[model samples]
Target: MQQNEFAIWQEFDPHAKAWQTLNNDRSRNIARKLGIGDPSTARECLDCHADAIAPEMRGDRFQISDGVGCESCHGGSELWLNSHADSSVSHNDNLKNGMYPTDQPIARARLCLSCHMGTADRMITHRIMGAGHPRLSFELDTFTWLNPHYKIGEAWTKRKGEWNGVRDWAVGQGVAAENLLEVLTNKSAGWNGIFPELVLFDCHACHQSMSDRTWGPRQGTGLGPGVVRLNDSNILMFRHVLAPIDKAAAARILEQTRGLHRATTQSRDATFAAARRLHATIDGLLPTVAAFDYGPDSLDTILSSIEADADRGEYRDYAAAEQVAMAAQSVVVAFENDGKVDSEKAAQLRSRLDTLYATIKNEDSWSRQKFRAALAALRAAAP
Candidate 1:
């Protein structure tokens, strides 16, 4: 009741509206059907819906109805609450006192994906979706910026650290790739009885009508029609994310990605084994992604890599193409932020960006030809 009642207070009071997305009829009904409606028994629902922390971690003022309160993303208030407020304390000190480093790329990515994607402890398997839950998808930089609670101004940089939108986006892709791989390798999470979890695969692979004819070859996956390919949108985005910083690792990831996809068609054991190898590869590159400077050169390289994917029909799946759109946004924001693009060029690119968004605006009506044309125009417009 409070989230909606205090909706107007979100501007100055983010707690009023920022995280209260779960107190709805739909969510309640879904939880009720799944026998997790009551707060006492709704651990599964509360994992993402509310600040369902350990009893010991919660303070006196803590209430589950707050729905993803400060402590959910920040940390428990008992230790760092006063420390974070003290100007004398360094950011590192706050971290030492239990504040989550939400400012960092890899840390933020993993934390967000723990619920946005899922971990073994809070797995949103195909069974959950079967119970009327929505399909989950997340873009790190996009999601963060879409409903940003704080601005990355001069003071933020001084307090936290350097802020690179594209770099964070790249690291997010790598982390998301790792999360998916973890699921594949985890028997309890990825497999239900003898069947592999369908949620791990592309939704359009089976959701689309048989007559739609969207199935085409993805060179990286090397799969033919009628195969339920893993939703490798994050893996695909690595082409752009890593190529600019580490080409050899990028190529190795591509090879491993293909192997993982092929393994799915073979056997459960093969899929898990391939996913483990790919997971290790991504895990290795994470620190590199986190530390690398995503400057103008790196941003330009990522944009060109995205254009290449569109040209080669690498975006046959809706998921991969969706990431392309988010990447374009991240790159454009970075380019404009660093004064790489003049106003005139940005104005022209705005329409091209709109076209790209329009093409994928409706997943049911997504067109490969239209998206490619839009990407081409954006590429041509960029300096």
Candidate 2:
């Protein structure tokens, strides 16, 4: 099969030779699937693989391919070359044709997300974009532009390719959301899965400074890293947005999120202890959430569930949760009452949640760090 002209070529740099050798195998196809390109030579590698340059380690020249390119996620590029260019090719086709494989959302997202989102391994700690290559920001919907060669579509069409964008979003949201929930539980280990939960700790609602703060005693006693204040407002944000989906579950999830936030403020020992308690509750709750049949018809069931259980009853301890539940329920009503969910209604719910989240952050109780962390997820989804 003939390669297209867009297929630029560069001589491999000895420094990058190792990754190049690995990339030269089928992994190159996966890069193409991701909409990134494959180029030889250090300069060209930087051209397509700018992510190679550590944001923190700039100014030094290295042979390692900088930006995550063709071989990074897909595996060695060698075996699939002949079939890759064929119009009949597919991600699974390439896998069958012989390339190290992965199909699960968690695994695949972890790979692409490694460089795309910036994690412990591939920290935002680098800069390849300004080094004369496309920037490495992430948005699952538009990211395919990075791998135009594969042509994954809005819907999975065989001729287009075999990919699951929806599934990716679902699992990514679930995992990322859960990770945030964990960090809200405890901030000291915020970087756990490399998803950047600390960013959520920026309580724009309460904190005067984004990076500076001292919530209370350091976890290690002597004076460890400063703590960020968090609050319960976003806990309400969660209840509002999620309650209409399932009130009892939403309330439970909100309290659990708050519990996680509370954990972050305490010592590691306390945090873990809280985590164990929270995790047990979540273990039972999440499976039930997963089992919910949340199609169009289920909307009424959710609304009734919320209506039957008032805020004064089982969920009295959670103010943020109640407010958020109301906000979320309002959005659901607006959505169901009308055929389409216009931007106005969505924005309204988002604004209410944001205000409530901000209000909680300003409170004297929970750390402000906790409030923002919980709200960030709502902010992303709402607007």
Best by lDDT: 1
Q: lDDT per prediction?
A: 0.82, 0.43
What is candidate 2's TM-score against the reference? 0.44
Q: In model 2, which range of ten residues has the least summed lDDT?
A: 215-224
lDDT (tens digit, per residue) of candidate 2 on 1-383: 22542243233322224345435645454444434566443333443344354446543443355334445455655669677667667757787665645455555555555544444333332123322233233333234323344333443354433453322333333443444345545534354464334344433233335464543331111222344433333333333334435566666765665565566666656656765565555444444443443444444443343333332232222333333343343434335344444777566655656554554543335443444344444433442
The candidate 1 region of ten consecutive residues with least summed lDDT is 1-10
lDDT of 1 by residue, 297-329 (tens): 887788888887777779988998888998898
Q: Which residue runs of candidate 2 sit more than 4 Å off their true CA positions?
A: 1-66, 84-93, 96-104, 116-156, 159-168, 179-200, 203-247, 276-383
lDDT of 1: 0.82
Root-mean-square deviation (CA) per prediction: 3.4, 12.8
Query: For residue 143, what is the lDDT in candidate 1?
Result: 87
